[model samples]
Target chain A: SQELEQSPQSLIVQEGKNLTINCTSSKTLYGLYWYKQKYGEGLIFLMMLQKGGEEKSHEKITAKLDEKKQQSSLHITASQPSHAGIYLCGADRSASKIIFGSGTRLSIRP
Target chain B: GAGVSQSPSNKVTEKGKDVELRCDPISGHTALYWYRQRLGQGLEFLIYFQGNSAPDKSGLPSDRFSAERTGESVSTLTIQRTQQEDSAVYLCASSPVGTDTQYFGPGTRLTVL
Candidate 1:
């Protein structure tokens, strides 16, 4: 089984400040996905990184896959209250399976 | 296009009872997946169905949990003899063929007392 460890179980950031969340994997991540979820709601896909050293951004959120493909980071610039949510990282493994990390709860303060 | 939909947004069941959750995938999606998310935890894969291929049940916690998907459409996840530990948010997702992106449904929250 593939194991993914996410750092900073919870984060509190001030509005307009930048923040970063990290997801690390013990095995190679063929595909890494970033998602946001409000408590008791469904997950919203943010981005997916496949190739090593690849980076993708959407609005103020940016995700990058490391050259080794074992780590991925999500950076949010000029964070706002709307950016507060639980950030989760998922890895697509063999046999078409996807495993997710425990998730990081992000709270943005005004 | 309409996103994935799930029925019985929240279900409260007694111990040893049976609960069934339904999911309707987006039109033309060939792959569907089921996952469970416990409070303060991440999503745990339950099962997966891709087209007409055999479903993968490796992630299922026990035999009391079973799921079925019909052709590329609706899916039902049945939990027999529900236990308190079974309480969680059951999520369903679907993706297009050859695409790794998964679109999720609002999820069915099951509370077994």
Candidate 2:
């Protein structure tokens, strides 16, 4: 079975600061997805990376898949209170089901 | 267009009881999935249905957990003899036939007492 590990289980940062969260997989990644969830709410899709060395950005957030495809990072530039949520990384295993990381809890101080 | 929708956003039941969670996938979607998310944990895959093929039940935690999808539209996940460990948020996702990106529902939070 494949597993995903996220770093910095929880983070607290100033509203204007920048932060990065990482997701590492035990095996080569096929399809990697980033999602955000407000406390106790449903997940909101952020982005998806398939090809190695692929990088995509949306608004103030950027995601990059490593050349090896086993690691991915999500960077938030000038984070705001709205960026405070649980960030999860999911990998498509066997092209059937998605396995998710434990998620990184982010908090922004105003 | 409406994303995936789930019914009874929250559910509470006693031990040894049975509970059903429903999910309505997006129109024309060909794949549906069920997952469980425990408190402060990651989402765990439970079952998956694609088109008319047999469902992939390899992720189900136990025999007490089962799910069914009518065509490619609605799906229901039933947990029989629910235990305290079964208390979690049940989530449903759906995707198109050729895509792997799944849109999630609001999820049904189940609590077993």
Candidate 3:
């Protein structure tokens, strides 16, 4: 079985501070995806990284997959209250099947 | 619809009763998936349908849990003789053909008493 472990289960940071969340996989990752979700809502897609050293950025949020394909990270720059949510990392477990990580709860203290 | 949608946003049923949850995928999407998220837990894959391919039931927890998707459109998840431990938020998602980036629905919260 594949396990994608996420670090810092919960975080609280000042409004202007920057933060990073990490997701480590037990095996090689073919595809890594980042998603954000507010409580009681559907997940919002952030970015998808498929190759080693691949990095994608949207707005102030950026995601990168390590060259070893064993880990991925999501970095939020100059966070604000609007960035508060649960950040989840997903990976392809098999053909047509994607599994999610435990998720990281982020709170931007204003 | 513009995005994935699920019916019966909330359901409360007896332990021995059966229940069905529905999911409507986005238009033109050929991949649909079902997942379960228990309280304070991550999403767990349940099943998946890709176009006309054989549906993947590898993630289903038990025999009592079954799901069916009509073509590439809507899907229904049925649970028979539900148990108290069956309570959770069932999520549905859909993606474009040949893509793994899925758009999820709001999910159906099921409660067994």
- Interface RMSD for all numbered candidates: 12.7, 12.8, 12.6
lDDT of 2 by residue, B15-98 (tens): 999999999999998988888866544567788888899998888999999999988889999999999999988889887876
> lDDT, candidate 1, residue B99?
51
Q: Which stretches of candidate 2 lie over 4 Å from their true place?
A: A1-110
lDDT of 3 by residue, B24-80 (tens): 999998888888866544567788788898987888899999999889888999999
Clashing pairs in 1: none
Off by over 4 Å in 1: A1-110
TM-score of each: 0.56, 0.55, 0.55
**To one decimal, what is the Cα RMSD in angstroms of model 1 from the true structure?**
15.2
lDDT of 2 by residue, A17-110 (tens): 9999999997998888888866323466788888999999999999999999999999999999999988989876642244678788899999
* Candidate 3 regions with alpha-carbon error over 4 angstroms: A1-110
**Clash number by candidate, in order:** 0, 0, 0
Specify the poorest-scoring 10-residue window by lDDT in model 1 chain A.
Answer: A91-100
Per residue, candidate 1 scores C-alpha lDDT tens digits across A6-91 of: 97889999999999999999899887888886643346668888899999999999999999999999999999999988898987
Q: What is the lDDT for A28 in model 1?
A: 90
